[model samples]
Target chain A: MLNPGSLTVIGLGPGSPAQRTPEVEAALAEATDLVGYAPYVARVPHRPGLYRHASDNRVELDRARHALQLAEAGARVAVVSGGDAGVFAMASAVFEALEAGDPAWRALDIRVLPGISAMFAAAARIGAPLGHDFCAISLSDNLKPWEVIQHRLLAAALGGFVMALYNPLSRARPWQLGAAFTLLRQHLPGTVPVIFATAVTRPDERITVTTLAEADPALADMRTLVMVGTAATRLLPRPGGAAPWVYSPRSVPAS
Target chain B: MLNPGSLTVIGLGPGSPAQRTPEVEAALAEATDLVGYAPYVARVPHRPGLYRHASDNRVELDRARHALQLAEAGARVAVVSGGDAGVFAMASAVFEALEAGDPAWRALDIRVLPGISAMFAAAARIGAPLGHDFCAISLSDNLKPWEVIQHRLLAAALGGFVMALYNPLSRARPWQLGAAFTLLRQHLPGTVPVIFATAVTRPDERITVTTLAEADPALADMRTLVMVGTAATRLLPRPGGAAPWVYSPRSVPAS
Candidate 1:
């Protein structure tokens, strides 16, 4: 009768260490404790029998109850989360702080592993801008009630979908992405294709290709991400002499 | 002065062979020739002095001139592309057949390596449905003009974004995703969310989660992948002993 200390979580993708994943580097070299939030534990890469906790991004239920009290004291923890720890990070505050505290973390052994978010590394460095049907929002309201995120930004802009705009503008919420771009200009159609990637696969990244009325939420911060296409996200012209990317068409061949 | 003979696109993520990367398995163990387009070269795993080729996906300029004629006969080519090889794959038909053919692939050495796309394995099995600012389109138009993808889906649903739909419906275009979901419900908000997912990270994957007026498009095909969540994509309640997942609220906790 001895099996109760697991929990993995992982994801660290879009910030790279060769885009982690050898099963999240063997669950961070077989963890033994690691939690996160302190700059995602300073982007893991230094090991000395591990054991680090670090927190600072709004306590996520006290970092999911200190990684379930170090997996209820059996160790092997882990919890990182930079991109894919089930998307919006911290695996739902470790499953809502293990269901608001113990049921014995239901006998531990949880797992998640899968990263590369940041809008799929800004839709792979601006191209295929997500290739059709899309949605993702977080204009920051401080916990639901900016009239329910402006009624989900007027219902994902009347649903002609294709969006991904995380914590859009930071510095204490710079006018909530300019009031979600004045309610997506009351039903899209301004020339679309607004990319603005930023630090995608690292190495000082920065991509831009505007339109949504010349986007410039003061050149976004919080490590930027904003990709808003659909109208079939185009902007091609790259063949041999690389650079111009974004594509979306999948049919229309016969003139 | 011996440069001209290079093309190395790579990616092969979302199918795990320990999620490749050791610099794409040492550029496919120092390729002698690989070129792709056949279940992505059967997800690469058999080695023995490489040399593959495989094709049959409407030959993008004959797999970009047969990987630049096996890198201009000097071999050492790679190609592949399952995810990050610059998104919609084959590294933009190997740089549009090296900028519309022969200028000596502009002195070779074209690296890419940044895999794991399939919307980051379906946004890591549901949750953080691409935690913010997203766009990715491809309702399958073959090449372009469907009035330029319905004007980029009406500028990504009027720009309150989050999307990632690639080659959405198939079996010869089943009414083009219901005519791009009736032009995104004339601008989104039929309760957004959407999902679909499919073989994300394989193992015969599925993941449904619907909305946008209960998506159908005759139940999407082409190995599905739809996403679409903005205005903070919700659906939480899986905490009871955990393991279901579905989040998107990037920031909100300053009551």
Candidate 2:
């Protein structure tokens, strides 16, 4: 049912139009107000009845509140995020806004539409390094302490988890990813595969597969997703010497 | 370009047709052979040229080899998997086969299509409990040792990761999920939210949101995906006493 005043949180799916689900497309078509980060909002096509409410990054909560306000005022709203909105995106912020906002807002209809996350999209472009048990950690220390990130990295490395690291490096936090690599090197074998996927699914996409020993911090930027494979991961040699296929096997022999 | 003898690994996206991406849909339309677990293969629409090759569960390697051989014989093959194929699904098995099989298989065109994984779909059904740092661990001990699963469970719990546990409980591994709960209970608060989502996005879908103290192992089965929220997760009170929203906040206060 199309509620007159409702908020639908939808993912844009890593900058590719083909990756967007039909449900998300329907939500966008129905939306009177589109609210999201500026880059993500710019991805949507301009329509006559739709109002684009684009804001800068790091203002997720403010964006969530704006969507809620629009919905409360009887506007059909779609809150957008690149990749899956639930994964380190605007869905959580929307819920946080609903939690702290007027109690009447709780009665408003809200839906979250899932999409292909950046980690999965990147993993797919370069075979599947996340084809086994994995963990996703955001290296940006904007919220959590650096100590927590360090501890989790050590835990993931020691546990033999294939890891997808989001926001690996930014101008402000240049040293965190290097420190994380150092911690992994201490526990994981140097032969383990590490994939650096930058701007995945976009025209400027770059996917590189390297070993843990050869992994450089500079290979990753804010737009990159770094996938570190477990010891069991394999690098298949391509015929004619193309980029090798990187993937983790499904089975692990009994310990 | 659509290669005549190509292999495309596609995700069915948690059982909903609307959840399937157009890229995957196009791959299905172009495939001459469809291979996967019985239930997932059964989801594909019937077509005159498509040959459905459905096999029982746990025969992933055999299925992969079959698909490869068919593709090698100049058939456009689509390997289908429920949810995202990369996440503990056929994508890994296919890669393993390619690495161990004839080197000629390496020259074949291969692609993996990402979809909405069970964890993401389950998270959206309620609210985004995975809106922060998270780990996905497969609970079935069919491959890895039980001890490894236990250690990772504890690591994820202690590390304050919102966790999505796949293959939580099967008939053969009925006790594994319970053991995981016991391990988590030691490190996490009893008030943390635990969501058991069974057959997500399917007609018979069941979603239960409970507290760590009250979560019952019997409530989950092989088809269930269990999500445990972090200490930072919130449960919003619904207006008129409906189901409360469950979500983890995007930011964490410094420890």
Candidate 3:
């Protein structure tokens, strides 16, 4: 009889060590093999019993399959990601691989451990831009067409949802953020607040708040998490004359 | 001259002690006053120097004002929420109060400490239903209107986004979940997966995965976090005939 091995997908939270949850830490501590993107896997401390498998970005399916195979071979495997594994991370890739791979692979013990998503960390750094109804969409067109992203952005804006845009820019597609801002300006007022949160929770984190008209798409890179506020979102003045805080009110007056 | 007092809004995460972040714990240890709903405030441990002010539900504005006043009076104040403070919690209420109250109130040193949101915790428990583009809406009509909620449900479904619905039902509003399901059925396929995750991260936690056609509105209560999947969401089979895991694939084939 083979000893039971398991697969756990864990989020490393954001950039800081404090962001990692105790549960995730425990899972990492017990892992026989750890697999993920290079930067994320590097965050895991080197332990005597752990075998680290670091791969380049965009090789998610290969990474997922390798982790699954290790688990199937009686190894406690942990696949890691920068933020929450479920949000634009390795969890979906693992599931995709498991669905397409061996049917017997499905019976392996697999679990996804949630971490503080980048959007939430960014929102907290500011006040609460996503306090009301909100939608999160990846602006990267690698998986879907640009048309679908445009349609969903329009619908989200029309629906009065505060939006969190992940993967706003990439090396290959630098113009996508500009297109997004141009489309949003047509329906939204120029004064609507937009937040460009870069490298959140890290020592070098930066958060800039601007209006839709004043926003320059060039400011956003792959590392930035952009938040577009709704008509009801308000910016509260900060004490001591610092930057104003942004938040969406919980209650909306019935029109 | 008095030193400026600070205010920190902390999310207790979901249920377990391990879920609370170290930053939140440090803030709690330093706070002179802890304020929130009775239940959330109760979660804070009794400390020698801490003053606990627990209020009833539905008095968010009052609670927020009280916290601000305490901060202004040179007391370190922490307003606690069950999940992430930015998501449908005290963060919004505090901003609302600051906007409507005296202009001087805006100058208080305030920060929101992020936590693991209930929806993320629930999603992590059963794989990743929110793996792709997704929206989160609170079903309670007390803040907005039923029409707005209904419109959002249709828009999210039509836009092909996974939806995480908060406050699905309460003792007073028993019919809202059923109404929401009925509206979603018009646009979504009957085979779409719906997850009812109750008391997540707690001992009484229960997870049920059902198709939209087979789902029962009665299963959801105030403590439950409901996730409705898009067409791209898949349920992976489990070994030994356990419940299949649910997740949304990251890639979408361009139509």
Provide C-alpha RMSD values for all models, in order: 19.8, 1.9, 1.3
| DockQ of every candidate structure | 0.14, 0.81, 0.80
Ranking by DockQ: 2, 3, 1
Which scores higher on TM-score, 1 or 2?
A: 2
How would you encode candidate 1's per-residue C-alpha lDDT over B121-199 as one tens digit per residue? 7776665565544566776676765665676667666655566778787776678778887888778888877878777
lDDT of 1 at A204: 81
Expressed as tens digits, the lDDT of each residue in A131-152 for candidate 3 is 9999999999988899989989
> Mind giving the per-residue lDDT tens digits that candidate 2 earns over B106-196?
8899999998899999999898889888999999888888888888898888777899999998887889888888889899999999999
Better of 1 and 3 by lDDT: 3
lDDT of 3 at B122: 90
lDDT of each: 0.71, 0.90, 0.90
lDDT of 3 by residue, B1-255 (tens): 544888899989998877777788888999999999999999888979999999998899999999999999899999999989999899999988888897777667888999999988999888888989999999999899899998888889988889999999999889999999999888999999999999998899989999998889989988999999987789977767666789998888877
Listed for every candidate in order, the interface RMSD values in angstroms are 10.8, 1.0, 1.0
Estimated TM-score for each candidate: 0.34, 0.97, 0.97
How far residue A215's Cα lies from its native spot in candidate 1, in Å, is: 21
Question: How accurately is candidate 3 docked according to DockQ?
Answer: 0.80
Question: lDDT per residue, candidate 1, A1-255, as tens digits?
Answer: 655688787888778777676888888998978888887788887788988988887677688788887888888888897766765677766666665577766566676677666776676565455444456666666645576566666655565556677767677777888778777876787787777777777788878777787787787787787877756456755456555666554333445
What value does the interface RMSD of model 2 take?
1.0
After aligning candidate 3 to the native by TM-score, how far in Å is the CA of B140 from where it should be?
0.7
